[model samples]
Structures are given as structure tokens and as C-alpha cells.
Target: SGALTRVKTRFYHSGVLSHCVRVLSLSPSRLRGIWASAATLAHLTSSCCVGAEPGSRSEAFHRLFLPSVVDVLLSLAGQLMSRSEAPPLLRTVMDAVGWLLSAHPHLTAQVLSSAHYEQIQMSDDVTRSETHHTTSCLPEDFLSQLNDESALLLLNDAVAQLALSSDAAVGGASIRLMSDSQRSFDVSAGLDSLLEKDWRGRGFEQEVDQLIAMPRPFRLSRRRRRSHS
Candidate 1:
């Protein structure tokens, strides 16, 4: 029998966080990787967290996956915020981002307010209405929708009071957020109120299930779950 790979519990190894960044740069099919990584990231940042500084993990995430996917997620955020419904995959991404930002708070600015973020500018106001178009005219929606990175930054500055809400796993397809008694990758910020009900599509469940279906204990292994943190 092949040797089992030990999953790292305390800290991520050299390539883990960077790997997530690479996967995110691929097609939407790679969403599962993002989900798994997000969950692990959350778990690592929890009280039983990586042996790092008070909040350096935020920079780690910024340097790893945020740069690659922030453009897409932020742009996607505009469209989702305007509509009454959202794709499950997109919702998962937002959930994951909120998890990370809520955990670090500092990452919220590093990501949602970056110079690159300023350049993309996902919006619906008359100024950006030409290209992005106004998804909704509801003053609240327009107001809450951060076109220039203001929406999420409020959380970092304690200006925005985002209630810590969570959605039950959409499908039994993704990786569990927690590996032990602590928790998987939860940040407590409820981003669900913004997006409507979940779509029927699978979250990160199927991949995990597929893996689980394979050889039981042998297929699973452990290590210090390396990270960019």
C-alpha cells in the first residue's frame, strides 16, 4: 500500500497558499480548490491557528490568491449585488472572501481597496453605468455596493457593521470547514443577506465526496497543512 500523506495541522508548508492562487487563476472549474483552500485558511486562522504574528495572515492571503481572483470576484460582486439571485459558485466565493477578510480584517483593504481594485471599479452609478450598467436602482443596494472598494473596507475600519452570518453547506460536495473541535473555516460575518437564496448547483462538496468515496483511511493523510500564512 502507498504511504498516507500527513495533513499539516498548525501551519501551511511552502507551496499550499501559492497553489491556491494558481488554481484560482484557472477556469471557474477550479472553484472547488478555492473552497478547500478557504476552509483550510479559516481553520488555520482560528484560535488554534498558525504560529504567526497577530495578523500577518492577511498579507499572506493578499499575496497569494486575492490578487488573482479579486478582479473576478469584485466584478462578479457588482452583478450579484444588483440581482435578486446569485450562482452558488459566486456565493461560495463571496463567503470565502468574507471568511478571510472577517478573520484578518486587514486583508479587506489589501484586497477590496488595492490600486488594481481602484482600476477595475465594479459599479452601477451613472458615472460607471455606461459599461457596468445599473443593476438596481434601490438606493440601499447602490449604496451598499462598493464600486470603488468602499463596501468591504468599512468592515476593516469598523465603519460597517456586518453581522456574522453563515449559510449551511449548499451541497454535501465540498470539504468540511473544520478538521477538529475548533471549526473549519468560518469567520462569522454573514454575507448571506446580500445574496438571495442559493442556486441548485454544487458548492465544494462533490470533489470532497468523490475523494471520500475512494479508499478510506489510506487515501487521507496529514501534515502541518502548509500555508502562505
Candidate 2:
């Protein structure tokens, strides 16, 4: 029965793998459940990639499936950013992103690219309100002003938040992800500029400098086993 269950599980995962990208188009109410399940599946598959030897079935599957999974994950992350009540979901997605980046360093550039950043536009009325003082600008007006440069800044901010999170797993994973991505893309200048003004205030200036200066290779840390009381 256990062997049968494992076979069935593989079939089920393969069945849904092809539809992972399409799942991103579902309505938010529907997507909330689907994204969670899909993300879990993706994370499991990522482990296969890490463990498989070169030129093996697992490696092939990982190479083919991971890019689409990353695309969907990035889309989900962008969607989550627009909602105030989606922090839990956002954190889950970010965790998945970090995991994938650690397992596949090549994915770093795609995940952190501005092309993946969601473009949010403001209405004409909001744009016209720019004449108002910066202090008086409404939140919508402020969001409307986020161009490509500002969008990159926001992306960096999200990464920094996760890198500095209270959760040790999240913080470690995010730092690894950011460092790998920076090394792969050589984005130090741009990323440094984005964090310059607030890095000192945020207390990660030295850490960021070190990460950019010398990126460590990706390694999956073993989970600590819990002892029974």
C-alpha cells in the first residue's frame, strides 16, 4: 500500500506539473489554494534537482520544470504584493523562491529581474494629483509613481526584508538567494545603490557588502531533528 501510494503521488504530481503555468491565471480567490499546493509540489521537485547526479532523469526533469515553476512563483509573488492581507502567502512564495534559487543558482537572474516585477498603473485622476506636496500624496499616487527604477528598488526591499526576517530559515535562505543572484548577475552597483540610504538604518550594510564581495556556493543545510520530550 505504501509503494502504491508513492506511485500514485508521482502520477498526480506529473499530471499537474504541465498546468503549473496556467494556474497563475486563476482568480485570486481560486489561486490562493492552487498556489499553495503548486508551490509545495515545486519545492519537493527542487530537492530532486539538488540530489540528482548529472545527466539523470531527475536532472532533466528539474531543468525542464523549474523554469516554468519559477515564472509562476514570480507571478504569484507579484500578485501577493498588491494585497494587504496576503503576507502569509507572500512569505510562503518567498520561501519557495529562496529554495529554488539555492538549488538552481542560474535561476537567480530571472527571479530578480525587473521583467518579473508587476507593473501597476494609476488612474488619470491620481496622476493629476502629483502637484500636491509629497507629504500630502495619497498612497495610490505614491504607488503610481513607481517606474522601472522604483520597481527595482521595491524588489530589493522585498529581498532585504526577507533576508533580515526574524525567522532563521527565512533569513538564511534569503541571504543565500540574494547573494547567489548578485554574483550570477553582477548586480552589485545597482543593488548597492538601492540599499545605500537605508542599509545603515536597517543594520545590514556590512552584511550586504560582504555578500556582494564574495558569494558563497549554494548548500542545502540539513534540518535539525527534534528530540521527543
Instruction: Give the TM-score of each candidate.
Output: 0.32, 0.45
Over 91-191, each residue of candidate 2 has an lDDT whose tens digit, in order, gives 55556665555556555545545254322112122221211111121132332343434334433544544423343333333444454332222233444
Task: Encode model 1's per-residue lDDT on 1-229: one tens digit a residue.
Answer: 1111223221234445444444444543544335445433333332222223324455654465344444444444333333333344334445544544443443445554554333323332222222111111112232233322443243222211111112223111112211111211222233232222331233544433433343333222212123322
After superposing candidate 2, which stretches have Cα over 4 Å from the reference? 1-13, 19-62, 118-198, 201-229
Task: Provide C-alpha RMSD values for all models, in order.
Answer: 18.7, 15.1
Choose the strongest candidate by lDDT: 2
The lDDT for every candidate, in the order shown, is: 0.33, 0.45
